[model samples]
Target: MPSDLLAPALPTAQLPAHLVASSTRYVETGLRGAANTVRAYAGDWKRFTSWCALHRLESLPAPVEALAGFLTELADAGKKVATIQRHAAAIAKAHALAGHDSPTADKKVKVLLKGIAREKKTRIKQAAAFTLASFKRTIRSIDVSTPTGLRNRALLLLGFTGAFRRSELEALNIEDLAFDEEGLVVSLDKSKTNQLGQAEEKAIFYSPDPALCPIRSLQAWLRVLDRTEGCVFVSLRKHQHLTTRRMTTKYINLIVQQYLGAPYTAHSLRASFVTVSKLHGADDSKVMNQTKHKTSAMIRRYTRLDNVRQHNAAKELGL
Candidate 1:
């Protein structure tokens, strides 16, 4: 019989060697999920397998009862609803990849997830958004005489103007930038939202003040880099010598915190852009154009004007 024909109707471990190898190859490359997502799922699956091993239970084609126990244990361990949800998704994908039915589809598992969410009553935290005035002030305060200063200023300005996620910023390249008389256009090959390698562009306009102009700051930084290609942002040496290596997402966050100071993460740049634009009367569509957000609901979520006075219609009641 052919190797595929000899594939056993058993757990993943008991499958024929050739069948297992083929399945492993498909799992690694045939999935539609993003690289980060695939890595996360792999991690979740590993944890689940470890848990199963400790309990002397089968991991592949996991029983619904075992899944319930696993999720319950996770919830009892104070895992967040979002984290638990991701774990469930990981388990589901693992079973699907192995040609087995996902026990996560069980009604009991669904109810368990719902109950966990209800009992936890937890919410996702939003990044702190600075005012437009504060942003301008911070931008102006950055001394751009040095190479480090030039790069930092450019990174911050572009990240805010483009409403770019840290990953997007990290993935940016010199070839992706195009300058025009009006402003600059950044072309992205892919992003967190755009996993299919769609052609997307973000426009950053020139500021009246040279000090706050993203194009000017980027130009200065690029002059320091002295190359027409490679990553837009990169690592620097102790003496501020630039390296060819791209900046990591964690390093980007650290840089943001370094310059913007406490409580402001890299996400704050994107959030503040949304909040400030909304406050200045930009509608969801306008904001979406820059942020490349697919939904108005996400735009609303990103708008972090915490004060009631920010956008209250109560004042217009004409009492």
Candidate 2:
């Protein structure tokens, strides 16, 4: 076997070869997680290290006071509570990987985090939900005569009906789709909740209106795609040309915002599904069946029944 295939040289050259190999395997295991999550952690750690370098403080074995100070600086700079917590987690993970005790584990650091949250009074902003009527209206405005319109229509309809995370839509491939008499089934090999690559499926039925049907729209787009394999959604250039480059999650958000406009994100597709389903009297279990939500609580969270008149019992009550 080539030496290149072997683990990188470690200080354990003086020890047994098996022990060194074991250590290398363990290190690899430490790095394993959802790709986006791992990247976020790395980015957080880099930010912390740069801050430490500016302050001439040791980053690897960060002192509790130093960690607390860094978190306070973040809060002072208007970072969200979740962002600060994630940064603290990243710092703690880096210290643990380097065989140093994490300062984030200290009582003082914990108290500082609580204080920051209380002082900031911050709450994570949720994506705005669009109504089914609005979605249908916007989708109808797209000119399907152009390749861009066909792709966008299919993308939006399928994304909303599937209740897919932006990442799931981006990762979708042609082979993952299965169509039959009833409707369409999208087989996901992996997703945000199913990072273990377990096979999960979402069912989509045909809408009575062909123009509004996800299944019909997808089929029409597939016909234009003219190939049996590769990414289901790819970039379309000017003058009806298409590129094989898979769409990114960021581009997905832009596509959604382009049509829906203002405060709406790609996440709005998923949220709208939950909201619409709940309005139509679909129970949590039925919604979860389509959304693959691990719990009923998440289904409730995704619902946007903010209108006082919507789903209220006060109107039905006898005075």
lDDT of 1 by residue, 1-319 (tens): 1122123234577778778767665554444367667778778878888999999888887999889999999999999889999999988877766567899999999999999999999886678998888889999998888899999999999999989999999999999999989999999998878877889999999989999998988888999999999999999999998899999988999989997887899999999999999988898999999999999999999999789899898979999
What does candidate 2's lDDT look like per residue over 1-319, in tens digits? Answer: 1112224334786879778878866664444456677678888888888899999998867888789889999998989999999999877766655656789999999999999989888876789888888899998998998778889999999999999999999999999999999999999998878877888999999999989999999999999999999999999777779999999999999999999997899999999999999999999999999899989999988999889898898977999
RMSD per prediction, one decimal? 5.1, 4.2
Evaluate all candidate structures by whole-model CA lDDT and list the values in order: 0.87, 0.87
Q: Which runs in model 2 stand beyond 4 Å of their true positions?
A: 1-31, 96-101
| Position 83, candidate 1: lDDT | 91
lDDT of 1 at 235: 93
Query: In model 1, where is the ten-residue run with the lowest total lDDT?
Result: 1-10
Model 2 residue 310 CA deviation (Å) reads 1.7
